[model samples]
Target: MNDSFTLGFGGGGFEAALRNWEPIISQTISFVPTLEGGLKGGMNQREIDRGVDGFKQLIESYFSNVALSENRFTRAVRFK
Candidate 1:
């Protein structure tokens, strides 16, 4: 039986988010190695870094889209 949790976050504010989620993050890191398959099941540092990078990219894109929309909205309001 495997009993462990994984923690991760996305977006441009990872540092800030980590500060708020330190406890949960610590728990997950501590638990991961104790899983049934251990690091061999892809729970190693490389995999975790890859996942975090992917999530960061996704979040950056999302924020970029939001910024574009906000800019357009502001432009429209000024022209109106």
Candidate 2:
């Protein structure tokens, strides 16, 4: 479980790094679970923040100079 989370964070961070490599990418990062999970139609404030936090921490912790985004990178149209 821990390994997976670490790998997941690293993978998402890599994506974030790619996204910020050029201006063509959007400022808002398309995050993973926490983001997609929080964005569901009925989620409350805490629920939303929890999801955003997962990806946000990855960017903020390692890429402090980059833009901070509250969004997630989901391949599906509806994450929920």
Candidate 3:
């Protein structure tokens, strides 16, 4: 849950895109630990990082449509 969220634009302007997705990024981060099975599950930082990376890829690559939607914003926010 200590990871940072960063949306990078290759060349075009994407500030709005970044802003639009902030909530999704925050929510994702908040729920990660709970979804990881908690302390008893013996999850380590590396595993958490991997999970974060996977989530990031999932959001950036496939969830663009959901990310763009106004209704499902909270679930999309990842944390930092």
Candidate 4:
């Protein structure tokens, strides 16, 4: 359980998003590992980085909506 949590944290920018979230920012990114993390039964750093790139596309594509994602495994917040 602890390992899963740690990997999730390592996989995504869960902490960074929180910092980005503020009244002024009105934006945040969320990335956490959960059941999906168990999809492959586990994940590695390289795979995680690759996954993050996918999310970055969302931020690049959608500017105003922010990087808010419906994904359970990950979410992203964008800031200027």
lDDT agreement with native, every candidate: 0.46, 0.49, 0.53, 0.42
Off by over 4 Å in 1: 1-42, 67-80
Q: Candidate 3's residue-wise lDDT over 1-80, tens digit each?
A: 34444533333246655765666667565545533522344777776667667666765654465545555444334342
Candidate ranking under lDDT, highest first, comes to 3, 2, 1, 4
For each of the candidates, the C-alpha root-mean-square deviation to the true structure, in angstroms, is: 14.6, 13.2, 8.3, 11.9
Ranking by TM-score: 2, 1, 3, 4
TM-scores of all candidate predictions against the true structure: 0.34, 0.36, 0.32, 0.30
Model 2, span 1-80: residue lDDT tens: 22433333224465564553444134434445447777677987887888777876865664455432323322211212
Give me the overall lDDT of model 3. 0.53
Candidate 2 vs candidate 4, TM-score winner: 2
What is the number of residue pairs that collide in model 2?
A: 5
Residue 66 lDDT in model 3? 55
Per-residue alpha-carbon lDDT of model 1 for 20-61, expressed as tens digits? 455434534543343333335567876666666665565456
What is the clash tally of candidate 3? 13
Candidate 4 lDDT at 16 equals: 57
The residue-by-residue lDDT of candidate 4 on 1-80, one tens digit each, is 22433332323465654454442234324433322333353676666666666655544555435333433323333221
